[model samples]
Target: MAKAVQKIKLSPSRDIPLNKLVLSQKNVRRIKAGISIEDLAEDIAHREKLLQSLYVLPILDPEGQETGMFEVPAGGRRYRALELLVKQKRLAKTAPVPCIIGDMGTEITAEEDSLAENVHRVALHPLDQFRAFQTLREQGRSEEDIAAIFFVSVNVVKQRLRLAAVSPKLLDVYAEDGMSLEQLMTFSVTGDHARQEQVWENVNKSGYDEPYQIRRVLTESTVNASDKRVRLVGLAAYEAAGGNVLHDLFEEDGGGWLQDVALLERLVAEKLRTEAEEIAAEGWKWIEVGASFPYGHDHGLRRLEGVLVDLTSEEQASLDALQAEYDALQAKFEDADELPDDVDVRFGELEEALAVFENRPDIFKPAEVSGAGVFVSIDSEGRLSVDRGYVRPEDEAPAAAFDVERGTDTSSTEGQEAGASVQRAAISVGGASTEPEEDDEDPARPLPDRLIIELTAHRTLALRNALGENPAIAFQAVLHNLVLTAFYRFTSSGSCLEIGLRTPTFPAQAPGLRESVSAKAVEARHESWKARLPKSENDLWDALTALDGGAQASLFAHCASFAVNAVYEPANRYNQGRVSAHGVRTRLDQANVLARAAGLDMVQAGWRPTVDNYLGRVTKPRILEAVREAKGESSAQLIDHLKKADMAKEAERLLDGSGWLPEPLRLADSSPSSAEPEGEAGPLPEFLAGEEDSANGSDEHPQQLDAAE
Candidate 1:
């Protein structure tokens, strides 16, 4: 042997009287954390014993004589618990508590022993604890019972049980540090073992291992219950039709997701069809049924004038009584901070009764009904949105009578000539004319397209300047547009701007968009305007004119925001000879300039690159490009080794506060130093000032897809 080995001395344990034990000054704990002493004491008393032994030292006198007393060093919580039990008379003062008696020698101080005892012990691994909970469950212990036994919450117990319910292979992967606890939790969202393994296989390859990505790829086919279609077809009815719903216990799922999208769509279609059939009975020539209609579905169509169907005498009497009761209730509670429950319920009942009277169908003339159709679609709130009395161009009545001498004009050439005569007459003043009318702008030919464009362009600029200078007028103009679009079903375009506020039907928007910063800002601004608006239509004029300049400007900006649609529709589709591809590009370029002048920063507007939003949805190269742009190459290199899914996640985190935006959101030609190519410069070069022109094709944005074709 190299040297003689030293032997270690050990401490002995013994039962000490509860009264004989005194609190140790050397014990290091000072802050109260974790379980409270009172609860610990109750737990100890309920079990009739402590789970851990207390560390103690015998009290010695100055003369080296022994005293029948002890001081605790480690396990202070257990000591306090025993003391509390004794004070509560649950334990006799003379009751004995088992403890380890340290060697009385001064070689090792009480403080060192106490610190070592508390610090050296290892806590149980979470996976092990989860498995143990599973074992307890298998042994017939209820979740509540297990929670009581372990001093934890029932939800905590259930969460642990859910983790245990995951496949054993995944648990092994978790135990071996092959996956994170959060990633393991993602597997718990669905119970199919095969799907879990499949997701794991995909996650294990290269870099696609984020928890959210796992959930997305696993449930890509499922439809969220919050989807307007699902909300339209009630969840109860969907489930009654044998549809399955999967819930996320860990996150705010907003009522969870429906697994069968096909079933949901079928149910939605069936409901919509039923509603359409009921509306068809209202004598419309035809009914167009859909979950959503294109933004400009009624474009170029003539809207029929109709009267609101009068309420029956009984309905009118009910409505009057409800209004009276509602007025009385409002007066009674006018000064209250909150309404009483019964009164609130009564008000809701009154509102329902009133709505029955308010939503009466239109009474269109039989002649108009024969030529007009209805657009039946769901609104944003999942309510039935019936757009009535739109007469398509093909359905418009003939302008002039055709003398169809039934057998005399039977030749194909004569039939064609008749159609040509009808077409030519359709353009004239409702009569046969060999010569153009005297009031024609040009009898020789129609105005040149380029000249018309230039004229309209000048008019557009003038209107813009006028609208910008007079905020009050601008507000009224936009309000008029909104009211006409909402109530009249169709409107003649009188304003040069051609304002139309289309309700967005984003079929593939990122989750939680309604709660986004931009969305919230819009909602707040709308509510503020709504509050300031006059209650009576007759007071609207005074109310709007009374507003100060600053208030008027703010309201104007809010209203004008709805008219900003930079979205690109293909000329091949919705242009209908009005807008061209070149026109779309020109409009977008001008819109970008306006946005820059307004200092509109998408980031400031509350758009951020998130996995659910931008990252997870794009291609790997796009994700990497975004990362490389937002962060430098060095930062991008850090995540370059990851797979597509993993890279998107890491990229999202790295770019969180970096103020990064996708190509669709970025302001083209943002910097003054940027150069423009020859011939592609802005037509109004004076407006360029310091801004640069974008390359010929660089001005197009990705969000240019048509809302409707």
Candidate 2:
């Protein structure tokens, strides 16, 4: 302020006739890029005026005198647009165009002025543009209006508005370039600024701060719409109960997350209870209700066999018509590349119609229903699974011995009650009621346990000696034991030899595991053998003896197949004292041996990496890794910018037929994999080599992530 500053003269702006303006050759832009001049002309014609002023300089004569015409050095595009308008007669030839005439006396050259004008300009920040959209929205402009004005889709407008509506603090951080756009995009899932900032603070320095991880943390408390509970209670029902759902506009969220988990749980329980009551009305002694039951829930319970009920004539006709219509549609569009919307809808309707007949319940006898109970639960696909006719061990009737004299067994309900009087009159010597009637004092006393054991021990030694001599009988005995463990685990061993086989049923399995190709083949093979075999277990020896060597071997193989326990369970790996890690590893090693023997190939087994099964459940980096491995780095790059869900889906499509298998599903190499500890993750890919150190850095704490987990 001590010294006065001198002011410099600035360039003057004035209106120049369209005809008076000439294109400058000194303009730096030559190649056609971005918007075309034709489009710009149309835009100018639509607006009826130019929004930006052109930079012009007077043309010099040979003697350096001013010419009436001016040349645009920086705004040549505008001059061409105006020229186009004038030629089209949309604007008069003599129309005045706004221009900022550069000082002719200045030392700067036209080219230098043009370059400065172009280089000194700054484009608006994306955050500013987003807020501008927000402002337009706040000012009562419909999203459609904003989209129309900005030449963008309404969805784009909505995405911008959503991004702008994120916490002001986060937006400020975004403005400061504190986070990437993707991280900011995921943080927009929630409106709670405090939670957003806390999450950012928790994961900012940690490599764990991926977009999907942030989204996972934000929605941790909320239940996924694809959850079994949500499927049991429809989305509309959950929303109608005053629940809020946070949806993502960015990716496929499978309908989004339900904010009210407690509400959803309560609704699921209520619906299950209602379903149970309905089933109980069908004469069940008791009913168990839940979203799902553990596999083998009826391990010790007896499953009563019931015949498939015949459909009514009306129902059968409807089913036939539906099938015929479906077939007709399929034949009609057999050569079509894609189906029409109506055809697609009708196909779904026809499928539903067909499913109704297929799912028709079998009717159990009244007596069986009175003694058995129902397990009303939801299947993996969220369909109601009413497992009727399971009789608990305690509910079973007391066993009655055969009355040799009457040639009847009194175990049946009617037999027990009706034959009571007749049997008592004759002083029955069998069954529970025949226990030592004081009148006769003639009853078969129970044999001493030790005496029986000694007698059976002798018989067992003799039988073992005989079985050792005869390979055929030994094979049949082994098959019998396997058959019991496979199909009738509830049946106690009756053979003297204790051949052990344990088939651990998986508590959780992939959806439709029972409907897989391999599963169906196994089922068909088992049923074919069962149809040829005798009904009673007591006749098993005769049935085995009746079979030829080939048939006996096939039966043995079929039964032995059920004993394969190749399933990997985390609970089994860390069984405290029951099962050590080495034990689990050794079990899997044996499974590998079996796999090699069977020439098992997972790809041929129809196990592919699908979104629902594998890809969609893993992290984005993992999906990229799979894509990189199967397709190549270039292919991975194509989907690198996509959100986690979209990336997983795209990766699945890319990995199709690539024969890629996750480590767990892959056959172990010839190397001793059993020697490696289960805790080792092995070597990561080159692209993700440093990710581990960053993800689990010693200085960084991922408390929020662990807490959410």
Candidate 3:
């Protein structure tokens, strides 16, 4: 019933002489790729034999007579390797090479056979290769040796090993293509399998898994060794305290992360205390030692003047020589495309030499040091920043008088020595109670609460300045208050002075906000006023009366600008009365009116969207919204496929110069209008619009304000 199976002829395997073999035209491999021929030849020389046999067909003349030479259809690389070995005298020309001779009577052509041989074989999976490298490493093969065998860089071998060292659970996930290689690499930053699995679970649960997020989750409790705080507490000190550090081998880690934050903080505090003790040795009345002090910590305190100590003659000579050298190097490199290495190194040396001369110590008088105190803290650069010579209000009097004013207590040795020594006070264990301290001056009541004290302090000084500068505006403000009091039934106004207010310090702000353009402008204005004002407060009125009308008006405007505060405090949501929710809303609307009158343009005020400022810190959705608002949906779509970090970066580039602003920074009057041409595209999504409205001021038309910024 069934046909008999036919026997088929097969290719025969044989050993062919190296010199008798030649590369075939139908070999198909043309462009150079993968491993180099030289490395392959070296590999063969080391092994002393080929691992795979070449597929070859015997060449013949038109007469069908054997030419005794073979043409390689497949395994051309192996043939080339042998040929290279023979040429290099590493092998004999007559050395036998392994070959599989294909029958000439076959239907398949040489080119098809070569293509099939090259393409049909399955390439090794990356994970399998990684495991193979790991096995070799375990067998005592060095990274360099492995790299040499594979014709790869040592770094590549190290990277594969690092990947192989990851948890088997994650490796299986990677094998199944559930996670990307980059994400796998991120997981490799930490060695704990539990942590790796935990982070993976968190990634799935959060559904915001990016490589950066994985890294952040893995190192959340850890502190970066390069962080200023960590730098303040040296890594050596942290390590000496038994703190552990995790290293990232696959990427630049900036010296890795310290895992013990509490230990680091303790070391930092101890070091700071030591530094504080040294500062106290200078006879300061008090030393407020802290990791960081609030901006304007010196507010309301008198700053004593100090002179810079003069540089010694030797130092002066060194500075002069370094300056000369630096100038010569700069001139020499000015015409060149880039500075030479030696010249750049010389410049660095010169800078270091010059810094010693530039940072001469400031010399304060002994009397000032006795009466004043110092703020011993760390600067942004991780260096100690000593703010000296601030005299607190209570300590303004002479030090002797200040101490004498507080009567001697019964506990003093002078008063109690004659009597049986009082029992020594018990040491307070743990820490002091967190209960609020009662006011010393008024024991029955807290001294106008801290916030009120701060607020009134700033308001009082600012009102004084405003009244001095703008007598006309001050009189009008008084009249307006009187009119409101006489005409209205109730008034809950906190203060009678309706003049502008200037806060002495911002309790909350972004990093480096003190260096912002607005902050600098205010500082410059304050300095200018301080210079012109009479030294004595008694003479302030006379000085103000002498000012011209234009000058008074200009000063009045500057003072009034400071009173604007549209900050939406949490009280508006809960505690409510000091600033009611509706009142806060109304306040913002009025503030917007003031801003429009003043022609405030935040962009021109030096606010731009940078990674540090806006882009890199927000969510991907928020970044997309920003790009959509600034560039349009199509542009937003172009980067939708990227991860959060990459999307944020790309969005920053696309939105640059598009004049986009976050809702809080956007002017109240800049809201889109209905009067534009019909069918105009690019309307913000409803969800984003709701978010913007809640964050931004009320609906005010652009035409209601000044021209667009």
Candidate 4:
């Protein structure tokens, strides 16, 4: 029923000499875009042959006869490239350029011919180009050679090769439009066809087949090169030791990932032990070595006070000169809103040079070193951390012994007894005397116990009322007590207020907590304040009063930070004696209020879900729950079939940077634990329950309310 397609005479194809061809003005291309003529020229030279025919018209003389010359219409760029090669002497001027000669008798104009040739051309698919490059590679062309031949960068060639090297099944999926080019590019991150296919099957089953998720699944088992252990060992040493690094060809991989985590950890431990052995030469009692020390490992052990080694004359002179130069530069740039690059860099150099002198290591006496040990470990930055001069209980010097009086009278029994009594009184303290003494305080007439208690009781109540009325004084009083407890050995405060907030240290190090951004910030703040404070506790009261209101508030906050105990410990009947179930819950609930006020973000605080810190410690179900909460149910199901350890490890990779915190570490606004089971830990403690009502004003003026600080 359909008419047959028209059969028309086609243009004659012929080989025209480059010298006979001239660019036609009828060509539609004007503005420069896509590939440059220089690159096209290089490609033509590299190929040694033209791949496509140019559209051309026969040049005519005044008599309307062929002049044996051709004018290119659509392929002007190609003509210019060939002309360039002739000029460069890479190709002969008379080289034959294949072209289609436009028929003069045809209805098509030269302009129409040019437009049709360009408009009707179909661009090669990216996959086809990749496969082509792959073919070239397989045919003994090196990546560099392919790059040179194609007029592209070597990395570009490598990326294309990687994409081509993806699993054949995946490539087919891509070719069939079942998957996207982006997805195929991610597959280029790995070369294991089986693993890639397995991941693809999982991705299909889970329906979370995003490119990033695919990359996560593929690289979950690998260790980040930025990992402290890898950084400590270094890439060169790791590679030299026969460990593999998986690098992504198409992305900024941050130095890629170290595949052998166990090997990395082993290297870290061995290096740490070697460092410890070298440190042993310094005469420490013992050197405890580890990749990282447990939090509170130094607890109960007395840290030795080592004196900073004083600078020599030459060192002092150098430090002074550096300081002078730095100060002069600062004064010169006092009004500068932004320093010049060179000036800024110089400032950093000056600061580091000065810090070297100021941060000199402490020198411990040989006698003290004999009783103290060193803790050799890697810090969170992957640098060797040496915490020296810690004395264990057993290694500590024994208490001074009590002995007989050397100059006892020895004249008579009465004198001997008196000498013994004198020696006991001099060496010992407190408790009732064994023998009665002559009454000295009875005549002075001390107040009766009941009378003293009664008199102080009224004063205590009045003091409480007065303290509540003046928040500033109450705040200062609390700070003073905290300061005494924090810095003094034996603290006794006349103030009746008892915050009794014990600063609890972590029992487990929990991976990177020691050097977390928040922890480091808090420690830096504390150290700055400590440096500004008077060393003696006796001067603390005067110093506290001397500070400005802002400084006073800051000091109060620093003291209050010690009271924050957000550490998660299971609450149950067995947790009695020390941590009651109710008490633990109430403490955490209060911590939530504080957390909300502080606008605390665990993610910004450098808390990440890692295998060592969280995932490895939880059950498989819990791991899936975390992943599901962070990356959706589809992602969670992707690794659900793996063993607990493997699942946890993979879940850790998925959860990293997801900013997902466990329930204990999570913060809720307004009311936390509202959905928690009732009677699980009984009602909130009376003090905690009344806290809100107290803030609004209750009986006994329930402590001064901190104004949302």
Candidate 5:
């Protein structure tokens, strides 16, 4: 059976004193019992300040039994304010307070009404709003409905719902003090209460010094994983233990945060072991060839050893043949003097001599006789005919008529003395025939067929110096001009010039010569020289017009010549102003304007501004004042002396005391006079300028003084 609903009449007034009005103890306990009275008072004051025109009313029962009264829905704060006013004795005890009342219902319906009424009229804190949303969702409300109720996007509702799952402890902090929703969402992804609690503790402990510190600590500690709970708990433990577990196991003594040192050491040791194994498998060897010529030259000993080990039979046979040939040559040379005197000896005679020499090599060998020896054929008469031999001192001198041919002495001293007399006769005859030999040698002296035109040492040094001074210019003048000209003549003339008489091509073929010269010329013209031109019109003009008209024309001509030689020729004459006569004229015009503005001493005076002087009008005093003001300073001036006065004391006094002027402005709070008066106005004192008498007593008000006092 359904109980009949009570009909309660609501008052039209919006402001009601909750103290004066009767309310059910049950409703009072549900609404205001747990709330701090001081907080209620503050809220009431705030609401009253926000809405100056406000009122309240009462509620009644349907039995006409006056169970309760309902105030207009906007009067909650007003009722609280009225209660405060009554408590403070601002309103008389008998004075009526306005209110409207309504019937009671279930807690949910009451909460719905409260939320609906207050949602549009007041701004709730975001966390409170999110919690409200969660409560609605728990009551079987869809995301869309929750969003509509709160007048927010569905995504915003969903986001708030997600945040609701954040650790209750962290949520409590969020409620008491504001925190970023993004940070809460990030923590939620971990889904670990302990981890979230740790994060919250760290953040709170940091006193919100830097927002990124929390995220940085978390990201460095954790990895992304689907089982966020286990991962988060592990991460929390890791961070809480100061990230030193691995260090404890691997390090002898406690090392701070360097737990991976053992891992790094293990890796390096493994790499070294691998390298050692490879070296062993590859059979590396070191050879020390001590103290030899061509020092430190290895001569590829290892390669040589390999080749010796791998030699084939054919190579061995070839080596044997080479040894045999060497032996045969040695045998023939053993007694070369005993061999044939005929210059045109056959292969057969050479072989026979070689074989005989090989058989009895000692017989053909010539005795090492000193001085001179004679090979002579003697007849029955005491006359001797000589073969090839040295002259001896004991031998009689040859007759003056005997034509003796001198021959090289191959024997020792005894043989040389035997041939000395013949040699002296030969020398004397040669001297007598010197005139004929000169005439015969004269034909051999026709100007050398190949002239070796070598430069003198000094001339070569000078040429090298010139090249070093400017290789580009020297190369162009010497190689490009002379060598190219000679090459052109040779190629076009169709003449078969001798190789020695041909011009040298070495200089022309030198690397980087032509390209370097071109690059240097282009760079000098564009960068080094052209960069000297004035960047501004005034500077350009000043440079040009420094001379008289005749002098200017001469200067212009010089400039034009330089420009034509530098800018025009290299650039193909396409951009003439770069170094042209007209460019000189433009520079002259600029100079004239500059000279007129800055007087004839234009070089010293510099250029004048065409625009008005905006810089001069900005007040120096105002700028100084602005700086002083930024530094929290004040100043006064002695007008007659035109000097600053010491106002530090006066400024301090103004800051400390309140009189005709209020305290200096502050950033965080408004003027003190703007706050609501907590009590009734106190009685005025006689010392006050406008006040004549005290309405209460001396305790009610303190004395105010005139400026003269």
Candidate 6:
């Protein structure tokens, strides 16, 4: 057979002119168009400084010929940087850059190799590396191979790959200006050119060139856009129009104009009412018609259609203005406070008048407080009292309460008969005194005790009036009071009535008592329950029952506590079903347990043998002898006998026969006993003690055994 032909390995290298380094538009990756000239200038400056020390440039060949020159495999930036330097007169035009060249067959492999060689070896920016990696990927390279070549995690490679999908404009911007990888990454994820431009404009306007500020604005703006894109766009446009959009939208006006929806509603209703009255006086009914009536029915009355013409021009104008104003106000007040009492009452009066005119009793009632401040009352007895803090006249009847006389039994016939006779007499003699003496001596007529409490009857009215005058002050005061009341009732010892006082001094003293009491109550209940349980139990059953209950409760509480801790604590590594150890030693122990259970020999598995394990107790000589036996040596016994000798002596003897002993070992003396014994039937050589002896000759014969047996 003919001998195999040896292939020649070429150590490839190349040099190319800067002018030939054209960006391959066909192979060029598409990216965002956001790059600016200023950024490009900065990138050129940085790249120039980086490529200044380069020695040679890698060359490429489309064909296998060594003289052929093609596109550069890598160093595109370096070449561009040099060109920029030459243009800027920083370097001579004739200066050569170092590069490695390869042919078409090697182009793909060379590009990959170049990426791997430069990815970590050089200090290029992450984004630059990502771009290079992305270029290779577009050329049909796999992520695994890229990761392996770059010695990076697959996830890292994948993350870098995302840069390829980034807008070409943005990548160009990064290449030219050297923007932060973080900002670029954020912009990549958002993929909103308009928003990105807005962010850029904002940063530039703010004179903030820091990447962090840019990143912060991008992140916050993107998040804001998620829910408020339309509003944000409108606001942006409004701002651009010099309308002070932010202030107009967020700042509160003092007049109730911006505070109450009912005010606007009432204004509209008033105008409508005036028109209605005029129409009524003209012996015609008022009606709402046309496209404005979306329900496809006359809002007022079909018979009132002709009455619409009765409205004077000025009146009609006012009505139209009111309607327009109502629409605008309604839109503004979509989230504004509801109708106030005065507005509600006025609306009710208007609706009632309209209802009377229309012959319909079911006019809309403006919203009202169903339950106002506490209502108190007293009977014929002159007693002073209050309910929910409201004091009422003594003679006024309690609308929500009633009284029953004591000592009136219906179980006995005479009592029942007397009760029936009294009722019949009272009904027959209405307004007539039954018994003057009994009425005078009745103890049920005693005066009731006085009550003190907060009053909420006119709260809404006051708030409305305050809002009308100065909404800012009114809103502030209301919010302050609400906060104070919350603090008082939720954190106070007194009831809501006592906590309603607005005085600063008194409120300050009582503030938080309710909270204190609630906390104490909880603690007290827990302590009391704990105290009620047995201190100790002798019986396992009782103990177990108590433990079961306590443990179950503890487990629930612990789980809840753990959840809370996971949210608030920084060191909570536990997640889902995975258990974590806090210390390295514990983790090692866990690893060891897993290794042992998997039928793996810990020592053989590369685990350091510990004194606590059997492997650690085995002598080196016996191990060596066993190793020799496992190698299928015919003279296993001789190897074991040799191992029994002093390790240093045996090593010295073997090295001496091979004439390779070190000076120290060669200088050492070896007695006959230390050496192999001659014709020994009593005991073999010490080195052979652990090995099996064959039936061949001993050291006395000094004969070699066959290799197989």
Cα lDDT tens digits, model 3, 201-275, are: 867655546666577678866777777667787888788889898877777888888888778767766776677
TM-score of each prediction? 0.58, 0.62, 0.69, 0.64, 0.19, 0.20
Each prediction's whole-model lDDT (CA): 0.65, 0.65, 0.65, 0.65, 0.34, 0.34
RMSD of 6: 37.8
Q: Candidate 2 lDDT, tens digit per residue, 139-196?
A: 9999998886666789889889999988888888889988889889997777778998
- lDDT score of model 3? 0.65
For residues 619-641, write the lDDT of model 6, one tens digit per residue.
Answer: 44433333332222332344343
Q: After superposition, how far is residue 662 of candidate 3 from its true place, in Å?
A: 10
True-structure RMSD for candidate 4: 17.7
Q: State in Å the error of residue 449, model 3.
A: 16
lDDT, candidate 4, 423-542, per-residue tens? 222111111122332232242443232222222222222233233334455566566556766786353222223466545544223344344455556556767888998877799999
Which digits, one per residue and each the tens of the lDDT, describe model 5 over residues 61-152? Answer: 56645434434344354455556666887545445454334444324344354455545566667778778888999999999977654456
Tell me the deviation in Å of residue 451 in model 5.
70
RMSD for each of the candidates: 15.1, 15.6, 11.0, 17.7, 43.1, 37.8
Q: lDDT tens string, model 1, 539-600?
A: 98899899898987876666565554444334545556855666666655655655555556
- Candidate 2 C-alpha error for residue 708, in Å: 22
The per-residue C-alpha lDDT of model 2 at residue 486 equals 83
TM-score of 1: 0.58
Off by over 4 Å in 3: 4-10, 216-226, 230-258, 334-337, 398-517, 524-709
Q: Which ten residues in a row have the lowest lDDT in candidate 5?
A: 700-709
Model 3 lDDT at residue 335: 90
Q: Per-prediction count of colliding residue pairs?
A: 1, 0, 0, 0, 54, 44
